[model samples]
Target: MVHKKESINRKHFLKDVFICSLGAYGGPEAHYSVFIDQLVVKKKYLKEEELVELIALCSILPGPTSTQTIVSIGYKMGGPLLAFLTMLIWALPVLIIMTLLSFLYQFLNQNNISSTGLRFIGPMAVGFIIVAAFRIGRKVVTDKITILLLLFSAFITYFIREPWIFPIVLIIGGIVSIVTSNEKNLWTPVKLNPQWRYLVAFVIIAIGSIALTFIWDNRIIHLFESFYRYGYLVFGGGQVVVPVMHTELVQLNHYMTNAEFLTGYGLVQGLPGPMFSFSAYAGGMAARGSGTFVQVLGAAAGGIGIFLPGLLLIYFIFPIWNKLRNIKGIKISLKGINAVAGGLISVSAIILMQKSGFSLENILVTIATAGLLLTRKVPAPLLVLFVLILGFSF
Candidate 1:
């Protein structure tokens, strides 16, 4: 009896360790959508309908739903530090991978062998982007006006190509929506917290970040600036971050090659977690030749840059999200922004099509993928997995 009891205790200890480590290591590998769904089902003690409703609400917002869901779960489980730790774990893997990739690319460029097998990734990536645009467009665009906006945005973007156009269009749509108001449920409040501590904490964190930037090296400063702007200023979701980062890191700072950026972006789409991991890849590559300390610092900075803003927004807004839920103006604005986001994705697809030099085979694949996404009940991650396999095989 004693031996059996000791064995049971040992098994329980190991099981706890495994779960904790899994949570940590699985951060980058964790699918934000899946994580949220499972947590609600297993841990939150929520019913199916409630889980669905929660997911729907999260999905409509600007940030990655998966990350937001996890943060929410952590907050519910253990408060702010747990939320922070969960996000930190989720971001760590990409940080490490991206830093290494950056070093490898730099070394390869120096050796002139960079083109050996990497050249193919570019066109393949364009194909993936084209597919993504179609997938997102089919769902978000329901009416002719939305379709026209999408096509017009694509055409304008293909030629003129300014980074700020995306957010500008979203804001314009929001303003127009507010003016055209019709919904009656716009101003109803759904309260979360009434205390001001969350807001105060956020301001303090921002101040600390600013102070840190001054004390750190230039690379660290650049990382903070890039992430801080990405988190705070970015209005739309993951896709918006791309253009913003391109403008800042690629066009302005010249931190990464266009090929490296796009490749990392494509890989991110295929990955299980949030798309923000692309920042890790970019930061890692950018940090190369700066030595080990700089590399680690750069990677950490990049990870923070990608996720901190959305996390902060969630914390500060949670108490007020329900209150603002029924605000007619906000709903209209969100609708308008969603329309613009659809347009942006559609435009991106068109660009990908041109760049990929689309053939019948590629066209068929894209059509099939989009059709599966729209008409069928296939999940996004499963579809992504299928495409990744298909992409490598073809």
Candidate 2:
């Protein structure tokens, strides 16, 4: 068992986080699988149960679920400092790639570069989600009530497909678990000394940024406010946030064309790490007036702005999570929450598979990817590289 408060090696933990970032393609659902493979299974930094709790907690909160979940793990390992570094290491590379891609979009267009080489990534991600669903499902689905809760959540989310549905379903799952369970004396109050300073900082930045946007006619301030708001307001993951961004950046502000925004999004899909990194591309493109430096600055603003609130929330809440979990009611509810989370992952694989197409080759790639992952034979990065090569070669 990994002990909290510096019992773990900070460097090694950060290195494993970097590895997860490199292999974390797709959105949050698929990203969770990569976390499972690398952090829980391979590294044994935390047990599968702890990871599931983190996932459920992050899902209920706003911002990037996978990113927040990993940060929570970092928080568990070595507190806030390590958590900050984990967030940076997990997201910085892809943020950089997305920022550069924002500039390279023109070059790619000029060269008529085909994105066919990224064709298999979607299917490969589905494979990861499938394995994740299976593994998490086996652990979470222990009883009839839990099974029903899982199915109910999966069915609801699959059909609804909205940002609000996720938290609502998870809340319902917890409530149902509590109502139906036969446990007595579930209320045990533990003192929670939450760090209120972090929450105050979160609110101050949010309000201050908005106020600054109105007071000053600066593009960077406006971009930071916009992206920061997106960080806290949007639920689910990058997929949900993208449309809000498109509407604001494309339709409202005319920062870039729909084509440009979509192009950057397409590029982000092939890159590993948080989908929120697409904000860098959009912010850079939006700030495209003075020079490359200004654009890069905009990208920096975007990357930091979008991730900051979530980090702050983690800072405020995660310290008390263990205390909260000590309540027998909370512990009982987690079973349902974890099962519902598993169902969400399961449904994601189906949704992604439909989107990627049901072609024979796609099916084969997904099956092969899942098979390799299950066997623990091929490393994720190597698997990703091999798939990219196949996409490029044939």
Candidate 3:
């Protein structure tokens, strides 16, 4: 009996470690395997079908599907503590890497090592942005109206040279959708936990900001503020956040040159994790001239600022989501938002394509990639590898 108990404890320990590691990697597949197996198979508390339903629900919601999926799973398995643990695990790697990179960039900047790299970053960045736009457009635009909206928005944005145009378009699109469609109940408040979660998130953020302020002596507060605000306000996905981050970091704070920022953006597109990791690159550049500690501190602050809002939003909104799930107006509003989201992505793709210098080779590569993505069971990383090889050879 004693031997069996020890073995059981060991198994549990291993299982927890595995789950935590998987959680640290924060992707849909990772979340599915690690959290699902642990919660359903090992715990044996929830049904498989229920787990599937939960996954589907998370998939439909905006934001990182994997993070939300894991959060839901953790909530089911062990309430708020587990949820926080799962989120922290998923966020840790990027945070650490970004922090380190920020420190390195700061050191390099002090020695003027960044200038040489900046030149090559420009054209590459344009290409990257174009690719991003193409990726988003291909996924979002299905209908004629959405296509029109995308084109109109793109033209207005390019011509007006205004950043606010995007949000204005979204709002107008939402209102137009409500007005034109014969659907009832077109607006719904997101379901949220009591204000307590928001309070907790705010407090945590405040403490972090204060701690960073004291530690780094507020050297890069602008960068920190921009990231924090962007993370908090950004509603759509990674692509939507791109423009906002760009405007703030490149245009507003002047932390990074356009070329440098674009290059970092391109690199991020090729990475496995969230686009928010771009914060690390930006923060690192911004902290140039600072010592290692300052660099890491800046990167961590920027990265956290970028992601904190999303985390808080999810925490606050989860409970309310359950309550509003059955509301008719909420359903209609979601449908409209989904439509607008699709349109927004399409617009982004067009902009990116123009910037990427789409040639026959790239077009063909994109089509092939799209086909693979739509039909084959291959993973995204593998697909990216295949395209990279093809692009290199062609």
TM-score of each: 0.73, 0.67, 0.68
Model 3 off-target regions past 4 Å?
Answer: 1-65, 102-139, 142-144, 160-163, 185-219, 342-394
lDDT of 2 by residue, 1-394 (tens): 6555657989989999999998887677788999999988888888999999998778666788899999999999888999999999999999988888778655655689766666776577667658767877887799999999989988987787655566677778788899999888899768889899999999999999989998999999999998998898765567656545765787568898654665566557567899899999999999987788999989988999999999999999898887766678876776777777777777766766675679999899889989988897776667777887887789
lDDT of 1 at 388: 52
The window of 10 residues in a row where model 1 has the poorest summed lDDT is 1-10
lDDT of 3 by residue, 258-338 (tens): 646655654454454455676777777777666667766778767777766656655665655556555555434433444
lDDT of 1 by residue, 1-394 (tens): 1112123333332332234333431122234334434444433333445445444445445555556655654544455665666666555555566556556555766788534344344444455455456555676576665565566656655565665565667666566555555556655655456557666765676677777767875777778656765665454446656655765676567887766776566555544445666677777766767786787677677777767767876676654655655555665666556666666666665655554456676566556655664464665446555655665455
Candidate 2 residue 55 C-alpha distance from true site, Å: 0.7
Candidate 2 has an lDDT of 0.81
The TM-score of predicted model 1 comes to: 0.73
Deviation (Å) of 101 in candidate 2: 1.0
Q: What is the C-alpha RMSD of each candidate to the true structure, in Å?
A: 6.9, 6.1, 6.7
Query: What C-alpha lDDT values do all the predictions have?
Result: 0.57, 0.81, 0.56
Best by lDDT: 2
Output the lDDT of residue 147, model 1.
65
